[model samples]
Target: MESIYDEIEIEDFTFDPVLQIFQYPCPCGDRFAIALDDLKDGEDIAVCPSCSLMVKVIFEPEDLEEYT
Candidate 1:
């Protein structure tokens, strides 16, 4: 039951330039979010603030260069 909701590519997430965070749609009608810093640190999980659902972000470190 603790497993992730899904595996989503980082490219599928919307990046907020100002907030420097990536977000994806959550089934709870909210969004799952992960900080750019967290991704840079090799963290791959994005969590929904409105629920317990989470997703594993699939991306390579080099893929984040453009966003930086």
Candidate 2:
């Protein structure tokens, strides 16, 4: 099975603090934007608006540098 990162094609990613979200374009033709609160404890379930796909993301404190 392909990983979520592989499915999303997230490279050189960045975050938006004003929105409290992480924005990245996905390979599946959707822009995957996740809220900071959603990613608490390194795991979150998010819905993709373009593809109507559900995604599970695992995060770490290091991954949230911008939000902090």
Candidate 3:
């Protein structure tokens, strides 16, 4: 199985209201991103578009209220 590059709190991510996605900096310079809908659906993986690295996002379902 592939390994996650890191485990990051949702609080550490930056939310883009226009994109409706949470993002974090990846080592490869591209941001790791996951959509809000995906999060709402209990998905936790944030992937970097330019690389293979992925981070496991840490957040409770209630935490999504602020983003919504």
Candidate 4:
């Protein structure tokens, strides 16, 4: 399992339509990415592609309707 540093508000992340992923900037110069399908399945954590950091996304289920 990965270590979750803290919870990040959903408003902090941005969506990419082409990639269909939600991303937030990481201190490592990489980004934390969580797929739409994963979020729909009740997965809240997103990890950076370059590092071992992860954060739990704070959002309600209904928050995903706009993306789905």
Q: Model 1, 3-62: lDDT tens per residue?
A: 799999999999999999999999989999999999999999999999989999999999
Order candidates by TM-score, high to low: 3, 1, 4, 2
Please list the residue runs of candidate 1 whose C-alpha ends up more than 4 Å from where it truly belongs after superposition.
Answer: none
* lDDT of residue 62 for candidate 3: 97
Candidate 4 global CA lDDT score: 0.91
- Clash counts per candidate, in order, are 0, 0, 0, 0
Per-residue lDDT over 1-68 for candidate 3, one digit per residue giving the tens place of the 0 to 100 score: 86899999999999999989999999999999999999999899999999999999999999999988
Q: Return the lDDT, model 2, position 56.
A: 54
Once model 4 is optimally superposed onto the true structure by TM-score, how far is the C-alpha of residue 56 displaced, in angstroms? Answer: 0.5
Report lDDT (CA) for all predictions.
Answer: 0.96, 0.59, 0.96, 0.91
Error of 1 at 67 (Å): 0.5
Model 3 ranges with Cα > 4 A deviation: none
The CA-based lDDT of model 1 is what?
A: 0.96
Error of 4 at 41 (Å): 0.5
Evaluate model 2: give its TM-score. 0.54
Question: Which lDDT value does model 2 have at 32?
Answer: 70
| Candidate no. 4 TM-score | 0.92
- In terms of TM-score, the best-performing candidate is 3
Clash list (residue pairs), candidate 3: none
Tens digits of lDDT, candidate 4, 1-68: 67897799888899998888999999999999999889999999999989889999999988888886
